[model samples]
Each structure stands twice: as C-alpha cells, then as structure tokens.
Target: MTEPESEGMVAQESLRHTYLQAIGVQSWLPRGALPHAAPSAPWVETFTWPPTQRFEQWEDAFEDTSEVPAAEQPVLPVTPSVNAPRGVSRALESLQGMFAPEGTPSQKVLESTPPALSETTPSASALDMSYQPEPVAPLQNPLAERYPEPQFSLVLMTLGELLIVDSLPPQGRQSFSPAHIRFVSALARSLGVQGYDINPIHHHWPAFVGSALNQGPDEALRSVRRLLGNMLKSQEIKRVLLLGEASAQWILEQPEPLDSLRGLRFSLRAGVAAVSSHSVTALLRIPELKAELWADLQPLLATRT
Candidate 1:
C-alpha cells in the first residue's frame, strides 16, 4: 500500500479504539493501541448501546473475537489485557463491579453516596442545624428559703449515710431494718410527716451515708454535717426527737445509756434539746412524744399544701 493508504489504516484503528471506549469496552482492545489517546467527546462518555451509524462505520476495523468468548468465559475476568484503554477499561470494569453480584447478597442494593445539592435547593454544605439544639429548663428549688429558719434544738448522732427528700423537718435512720421500716412508716403516718408510706430506704441517713463515708473521715463528716445543716435550716425545726440512742450517740459521739431517763435529753442549746429514745418502738409507747412531734408537724403539712 502507498504511504497515504498506510496512514489511513492507522487513523481507522485509532477511531476503532475510540469507539470501544464509547461503549465502555476499552479493555477489549490491544495494549498501547491508541498511543496518543485524548479525552473522548461527551456523547462517547455516556454512550452504552453503540449507535447504529457509528457501529456500521467501524464494522470492518473492529477486532475479530468470534472464537474467544465460549471456552474461556470464566477466565475472561482474570485476563484484563483483552479490555480496551487503561483509563476507560478501568472505568468500565468499575461500572461492572457496581452491578457485580455478591454471594446471596445480590438482591440487596449496594451502598451509595448521599445526593448532592443543586441550584434550586440550599447547599447541604451550609447546614446550621447544630446551633438549633433543644433548650434546657432551669433547675428548680422546692424549699424556697422564704422564712426565718428555726434552729435544731438538739441533734442525735448515728453512723449512716444521708440523702435528701423534700423540705420540712428532716430525719434519718440507721441502715435498713424491717423494724426500722415499720417504725418510720407508722411515725410518718402518726406525725403526718411529708412522705410516702412505702419502705423507707433512700429518704434517710443509713441508706445514703455509707456511699459518702466511703471516701474518708473528712469527706464523711463534711457530707454528714452538710446533711444535718440542711435539716437545721428548716423553719419547722424546733427539736429533733432522736429515735434511738444509736442516732443520739451519732450526733453527740458518746454512746449514752439507752434506757436511762437522765440520758434521754441532751442539751444542744438553751432552747434546743436532743433527746434519745430506744427506737421508734419507744416513741410508740411514749404518749407525750407522739403529741409533741405531732404538734411540731401540723404547720408543715399546711405549708406544703
């Protein structure tokens, strides 16, 4: 063939390579087939089914692959040299990978990226929902420190943890006891103390102190005194009828005789009196104390209402 004829064949081959890429089949062509390959036009980029006009134009120039498809169909993926250009072949293979079936998972759709923003909608890049957090309400104080608080006439001592409930005359018992449970419930009912009659566990010292005292003596006393001081600040606190010598001893730090009438009252101040009883069992028997505590509590219930 003359020189013009040879150049024409080369140009035809390049066009055929371009066409393979247009159909997303760049990997099927020979290596280095298009030495100076340029980016194909936009029509070629999205083209899937080859247009009939272009197909006929390059029909004879296409590689003849009639014999290669049948026997080696399984190994065709392992040999990528049979594909087209490096970039185009990679892209087509990637597209094939997207649709490639997975083991028993083919029915499920593969993960995709989030949708991008367009001119008609606000850019997701400028999202400001972070500052639009829910507003939090302020903390409430039920004991509104309104009146002149009375001093606790006397304090009974006991060794236990303390926790708080609502405001009013405050008290605590030793660690949980069925007898203590029964005692506080009846006393709470009898005295009309502001609380539920359920098993009295958390609203007192024994339940709360151990956890606080676990830290150390400084922490324990600070915590215990802090609890007691809060009770002392109650406007209704005139005197604390210490239910047990154990509780009384906790306040005074010297275990006094439990049954002695002389040890019953500890003079905390001229007006304040800390009196130890045997237990709520004693209070049940003592008619005068039941009346005194009852009188001490009447105004508290009215204030709560």
Candidate 2:
C-alpha cells in the first residue's frame, strides 16, 4: 500500500477510538503503535474490584457491636395477663375501700357488678310487644300530574307559497271533514291555486300515546315550530294562514283571544307572514264568522292574486 494511504488509515482508526472513549465505551487498541501512525497517549489499566484489606475492614464494621450500649438494645414485647398490673390493682383496691362498707371485701364488690354486655343476649321481654310500622301512602305518578294527557292535533296544508294551519276537534274525528275540505277548496280557487299544488301535513303532540314524554304546552309549541320549519324548507311558503285559537297558540305561541288576533298580520320565523282567523268548524257552525274570516284574508288575497 502507499505510505500516505497507510497513514490516513491509522489516523481514521485513532479518531474512531477517541470517539468511542468520549461516549464512555471501552475500545480495544493495538499494544504497539501502528507504522506511520502519530505517537498516542499511553493507555492506563483501571481496576474496579476493591483490595482484600477493604473487604476485611467492611467485615469489622458490621461485626463490631461493642460501641452500642445494652440500654439501647430492642426488647421483645411481653404478652398481657388476665390480672391487672400491680399499680392498677392497688388503685382499684383504694377506690373499693372508699366506696364499699367497712367490712365488705373486693370479691363481694366484683360479684355484685353487672354482667358484661358481650355475655348477655336480648330476651323476648326486652323488645316492645306492640311495635307497629307507620302506614305508607301509595305512590302517585308525577308525570301524570305534571303533564296531563295532551289533547292537541293539527293539520297543515300548503298551496303554492301560501301555507294553511288548522286544529282538529279534540273529542271527535282527527281529519278534515267534507264541509271543511270544500271550504279550503273554495279558498284555494279564489287565490287562483290549482288542486295539484295543495299538500297537507298532520302534526300531533306527545307523538306516542300513554308515553312518559313531556306533552305540556311548551313541548307542543316546540314540536309545532319544528314541524313548520321542516315544511318551510320543502316549499317556498311566503304566507301562513292560522285557523282556530289552538292553531295561533301552537304556531305563534300567542295567548291572546281569537277575536283580538283576527285581521292582524304577524311575522313568523324566516320572515313568513301569518294571519289568524276562525276555523272551518267554527265557520260551518256559525255562518256569521265566514265574513269575519274573509275580512282577515283580504291582505293575503291581494298579495296572491
């Protein structure tokens, strides 16, 4: 090999050993210096094992007990006896002398003492013979009391952009009667709405009969609003016609009288216009209400036609 190449190889080996030693790893090196290599520091051998004398010194440290005094030694605990200690016995004797009659002995005083509670069992005579449990009232259903069975039902119909909401009779049939349908058909014709554009949506509160779900007025309002909001998304309804007091109460959450709410246009969520009027059932029963309903619808009719 060339002299320069051999020197470079030696230098690389030395650098590797230096790196290993710096990181705390013991690396083996040639005993004799490599040819053409620079003079390196002498390697010193280190021994970790202690000398024999050091082991002898450690043995002496553990074996030598002469420095510790006998008074500081630990003693085993003695088991307690049934009889009282000497000091306690003397104290009891003095107490008995002061309390008992002049001639009475400690034996007599101990004999007159009551039996230990642990040794005595309760007798039948010890318990009260006439113990009676207090009467417990029957449990009443809180859900039934808090929210009485909800009696609300409604039908929502849409014609083009005009939405109609009417409440059904709570006691009788649920769907719209023939007379009611005829009235709605006539109303649709007046607004120039075709029969194909008419769509009806039924909404009932509490959803499930005899369920524990909350069917209060507040829940009814929330349910109706959600129903209407979904209906509005499906169609582009610009106006809402609320028929009957129940319809206004459920949809608008208005507690005012039906007469007061009639003939006035209100704004619903999403900027839809709403008008209140008497229901078809009311119109059929009292023909006089038909004129009042027509007056309320004038504004809506003007916008439709």
Candidate 3:
C-alpha cells in the first residue's frame, strides 16, 4: 500500500481503539510500537494500600464547634389579609371560624344566620298529613311477564353428517306436511343423501305439562341447547340447516329476519357449521322464496357435491 493509504488505515484503527477505551473496554496493543501507529502511554496503577493522603479523624472534624452558630428557628408563612380576593378571604375566614371559640363574633354570626331555602320548597304549614303520595304499582315478574309463554315446535332431522332443523306447523304437530316431506326428500337426494338415511327428532318448547315450572325463553333456550348438544355428541354432525325463523331463534339464538341470515354460515357450539333459510311451509306458501332458498342452499349443495 502507498504511504497515505497506510497512514489513513492506521488513523482509522487508532480512532476505533479510542472509542473502545472510552466505553471501558481494555484494548490490546502491540508490546512494541507499530510501524505507523503513535507510541502508547505507559500504564500506571491508580490505587495503593494505606491511601497516600491522610483522612482527618471523625473526632477532630467535629471538635471545631465554636465557629458554628446554633440553628435559628424556622419562620412560618404570614396569613392572607381581608384585602385579598373574596375567595381567598372567605377560605381564610372559614379556617379561622373552624378554630375560633364558641363566643367569637364569627360563631355568633353563624348561629344567627338562617339556612337559605329553595323557591320551590313548600312551607312547613303546607306539608300536612292529609297530603299522600300515589301508591306505587307492584313490580311484576320481569322474566315470566316480560316474555310471552314461548310456544314453538321444531323437527331436527339428520342425514349422514348434516343436521336439518325446521319449524313444524302449530297445533302440536310432530310431523311435517306431505309437501314438506317431498321437499326434504328432494333436498336430501340433491345432497346425495338417501330418504331412508334421514332420521326425524321432534323438539317442542315448554315441554312441561303445567305452568309450575319456569318455561321462559331463557329456560327454553337452555333446553334446546342441551338437546342440540346431546345430538351433536351422539352423532358425527358436521353441518346444520336451520329452516324458518323459529328454528333459527331457538337453535342459533339469532332472532334476525331470515332474509338477512339466509345466505350466511354460522359456527355452532361444537364447531358445527349452520345456515338458516325460509321454512318449507313458507316455500310452499310463497313459491318466490324458493329461488332465494335455492340461492342460500347453493353453498351447502356445493360442499355436499
């Protein structure tokens, strides 16, 4: 290397060593000086036994007490005067009144002063025993009276791993109409499921014969969830088809309109996929809903195929 390049490299190394030493790192150097590097300073030990300079004894340091004067008393802050701001003066007066004796002028003024009354407040003479408040209505049972007696019927049918939840007709009917039967059979066939493979399980709300037991929505929901949980445990159910609003409400605990919930998939408690659609009865009554139901069923059909 040329002379200037060699000098520049040595300077860079020296700068790096300086940085390392500054950060408390002990940098190693050649025992003999380098060709271009500056001579390093000789090392010296800073500490020595029996410290070189003498420290004065504790007794000797405290012995010269004659020159030190006694500590003066601390001064207290002066109290604010009456000429101060109204808020400051009032605060001071209140503090003074709090500590003042019973016979003081402040105490006397407080004793003579009358409490301020509101303009709307009635006089003592006007409030008589004859004036009576209206009797408060008895609190009704919020749970039982708040929600009407839940009356709904649903049929839970399983075909292979698919669970179909549909609302049954009113009047305690356990089975679906012929039209519903045909529709379900066709749907099953489309999904590559045989008619014989389909098993119907009836679920009726407010199962109790009498009104003695609590049969509110909460209780009904618990009952339905319990039944669904039991079914999920018993069968290898993977997907759920919720038909009608009642089936959706009780099974999914979702009371939204079927139109809003129809095409969307939901995750059930046991990781089962669920989809809600119009009831078979509704499809029969209003044929136009079939097209919407068909659109909704397309995703499930695609999965099945």
- Output the number of the lDDT-best candidate: 3
Mark the 10 consecutive residues where model 1 has the least summed lDDT. 159-168
Q: Over the stretch 135-246, how does candidate 2's per-residue lDDT look in tens digits?
A: 9765333233433555667889988887889877776547776777778878767666766544567776657666676666556655776888898999888888899877
lDDT of 1 by residue, 187-249 (tens): 444434435434332333222334443343333334445666665655335444454543444
- Per-residue lDDT for 1-305 in model 3, tens only? 56555544443443454345335576654556678887653321221112122112211211323354433322222244433333433443444444344444566347656788888899887787686899976433323333467788888888877888898765766567677877887876766777464557778877878978888777777788889989899988877888987788777676566667887878885557888899888888898987888788776766563
CA lDDT, candidate 2, residue 111? 70
Local distance difference test scores for all models: 0.40, 0.64, 0.65
Candidate 2: which pairs clash?
A: none
Candidate 2 wrong stretches, greater than 4 Å: 1-150
> Residue 222 in candidate 3 has what lDDT?
72
